[model samples]
Target: MHGSFPRLDIGPLSEYREDHFMIARFSDYVHEHQSLVFPHRHSFYHLVLFTEGSGRHTIDFHHFQAEPDQIYFMIPGQVHTWDFEAGMEGYVVNFSDSFFTSFLLQPEYLDTFSFFDQDSSNNVLKISENVRERIGQLFEELLAQNARATHWRDDMVRVLLLQIFLIIEQSDAVDRRKSAAKGKNATVRNFIRLIDKHYDKVRLPGQYADMLNVTPNHLNALCKEHMGMQAGELIRNRIVLEAKRLLINLDLTVSEIAYRLNFNDNSYFTKFFRKETGMTPEDFRKSPAI
Candidate 1:
């Protein structure tokens, strides 16, 4: 889809481009501006805690129900939009990658949080009201520190932010364990990983099947069992997702995009895209995100 909202570099939060962190409550954000209706991408990571709300939040075109005590994290460059009921209450934390990467020798300092990875795209996590009490206190403290002018405000704020992340990590560990035990789709998972790494060069399901050491039929069966789709559909879906992203975010033409995505013939690319998405490349580029 095309961008209706102003991109971050041009939006009201453009000041953040020069700063490392900024925290705002939902009430103040709404009071300052009427609504955040436009779908936009940000230059920094976002941690939006929904303490009170009932509506929807869309990240990377994946829609999630907004409920009380739920938190949504957005990685940099991920596109999102929200439509929450009026009078909603929450806190929004914006920080740059540099903020967390300051003290790290290696990437593990921030990489430990896998949800922050763009691939997972940092979806929603529902927190219990009891846990929110503790976490909410920390946020309130952060808000308090954010408001008062102090010499060590930025450093102190960074410390508090890391604490919140640790809290989330501890609270979500059990959920991760349950997730690991549930579904158990290693084949599909590895297939997706491989697809991300090699989708540009490999188009055949047999190639992926060979890499995964399984017959194409077995791979298809596992994929259908977990994702409700077969091998070819998953690969095509990834290609279409990338195509849509490039078409929407870049100024490239259909032929350029086709070639950039490794299609040798533009017409064949259009037919393949049409067969998978029911729309030609031009039509799909003109369309909004589905």
Candidate 2:
């Protein structure tokens, strides 16, 4: 069985104070935190911009090829691991969930970025050649700002980081502006956030609709329009995703996972998993990590 990996906090991963923010060159970060090569979870926001590399990595079980100018984002609680060539180099940034809370009036501002949407499929982005250098430059500025304790150092760091995010969001090849506008819809965004918080206990779309002060049909229509799926599918997908994440940790038995997921019994959970993912929990656990 695969060994269970750790859920790392920012304090343990860096030599600096636990000031809720850390920045370093990718090579230095890797050298200092070699154990991160193993599958692990982070209790903070994590992002890496690969300036040069050739290998592969995983974000919440989704596989991605590591390449120069390719950047990936991981939110709190997502699992991540990387395997790269000897000459790999880049920048890595880790910040606590509250990193922007006090700085921004709207604490959920980061969620507006597609890359930070918590969907593994949207976690990675290709930095176009035009803005690649500028992105790297911003990262360099971040490294510098983090090293000094000058006046307003943290706010300067925040401004630079947001600059990098805005650049990526503006130039992303995916043409996310339209979808991003849709995502800003308070009802839809709130629905997704609710699902993330209560997926285990609240399993029904109708219940979520009730909480959101909307009808089930209206909620389903909104999800279908923006997320390309019905409301119920959104809930089920979150549950299946949690099952897969929990399955990666071999120490937990199927029954325990089922209980954690609010499933009544192991057999019922197996049936639901197979229906959604076409594999039993044990089967998924045994299969190779991709």
Candidate 3:
């Protein structure tokens, strides 16, 4: 609860400090990097596949119970921590944001996966028992390839990781395919990326619409159709989520947080937070995490 005003951004484990990629058994990773048990952020993309575990993990204040065959993906900069029973074992992979960009000509290729969309609720998935063994085999291959330095090692690792992503994507392909059929999947994803990049300064749907080269109404329609919410609501939700994340850092005063979020003043920020979450900033800060 108390440390830096902003949470710490942990780099790779000490053993692989200079490398931009790492793979390990979950138990080994946890044992080697105990600091992760505390509230912190990561500077690299992270994913974990659990073969055995019980308890829960929190990503950006959202709680998810730990379970076998359940996998989770996290992009850089999200807060994460976990509490699990003894004997938790699985596979974990950490790679730089550029891990796939250079390999694939399409820079946004990874974005097409719904789990990497920066929404905490969508980042966790349960693996159907049918494909569980295949997924485990892929992880085994990733681990083995990572251990060797012979012949295109990095490329081999990248391909294996993509295979894993493709398998998981198939599980949710129906919903994603439906969104793609709507013919606005790319546009909506762009809008979301823009919001993530500019939410602090841009507050209006019109601003985002202008950036996206579409009318505000068109933008709203796309969001409503694909995301089940108006464009403005999406922006507000991102802002509020950031607020909640910042409030978790006990070292930061409310006024400091307000400034960080670019609110005009402390009072206005409090009002905005209260309006969106139905709780004052202080109240939320003091509340116990689920």
Candidate 4:
């Protein structure tokens, strides 16, 4: 018999669990047909191991063809979707930020692994047969401990999860080195993170430079070197992207969105929006594609 797709809520880790980690092995009978794993954000991290079947998976804006022995690590708050065929078998592990902090705070761990990588979707780790066997063993052990209600089950699970993260970290390190040598620099990464955190509050290069503790000229130079765009252009692009997302996804009025984005006045916001986007926010919202 088939089982329902489990939501597996464990409540907050501060309540009962000593550490915020949960592991479960999925059987082939369970199929989430209509759910589509809708675009949503999470406060915890996810590590999905696809042991069998094929599908189309999208993380952030990039898409991938899913196959057996492929692993996807989705950080918190990233939008993702997956559609798998019937009889898919794998494991879905979720852990909170505090769970990782216990291990990630170590100097060696921080040096070896990047907590966030901008190109993670393009460089997913391919699990080998040996690694798959080890992971399966870990999952079985975790399930057994949970079933027996072991006194130290949470701690044991934390160790196992750390092992898995170490394996993942190795793969991420390889990808990171390649990306660092060929792609954006640390400044761009920081810039992107800042934008993600405060895009709705600030949209000026001077403001960003002040936050980064650098002169606007220096920030612009760094941006041009890594992203091949001026700092002001990047800020505008981010604002426009947020504006588009709001226009397409929410029922909020354009004026409300402009105010939410901290525009000084509605008229200026509309003018700026039209200058950055080819069409006005209203027209963009009414377009059939939206």
Top lDDT model = 2
RMSD, every candidate, angstroms: 5.6, 2.2, 2.5, 6.3
TM-score quality measure for candidate 3? 0.92
What TM-score would every model get versus the actual structure? 0.69, 0.94, 0.92, 0.67
Better of 1 and 3 by TM-score: 3
Q: Write the per-residue lDDT of candidate 1 for residues 1-290, one digit (tens) a residue.
A: 35554332227676765687888897787677564566667878887888886887787767788887888777666677777788788998888868756655653355455346444334578875557888898899999998889998877887888787767766743357433322266677778778867887898999999999999999999888766778898888888767765665445678888898899889988998899879887786566543
Which lDDT tens digits does candidate 3 get at residues 161-252?
A: 99988887776422564435333488898898898899999999999889889999999999888888999999999999888877877778
lDDT of 4 by residue, 58-116 (tens): 66546778787787776655555566666677877666657656544552232234434
Order the numbered candidates by lDDT, best leading: 2, 3, 1, 4
Alpha-carbon shift of residue 30 in model 1 (angstroms): 3.3
Give residue 168's error in model 3 in angstroms.
Answer: 1.2
- How does candidate 2 fare on TM-score? 0.94
Tens digits of lDDT, candidate 2, 170-278: 8844456544744558898999899999999999999999999999999999988777889999999999988888877766789999999999999999999999998
Order the numbered candidates by TM-score, best leading: 2, 3, 1, 4
Off by over 4 Å in 1: 1-10, 33-35, 119-122, 172-174, 177-240, 247-265, 268-289
Total clashes in model 1, counting residue pairs 3 or more apart in sequence or in different chains: 0
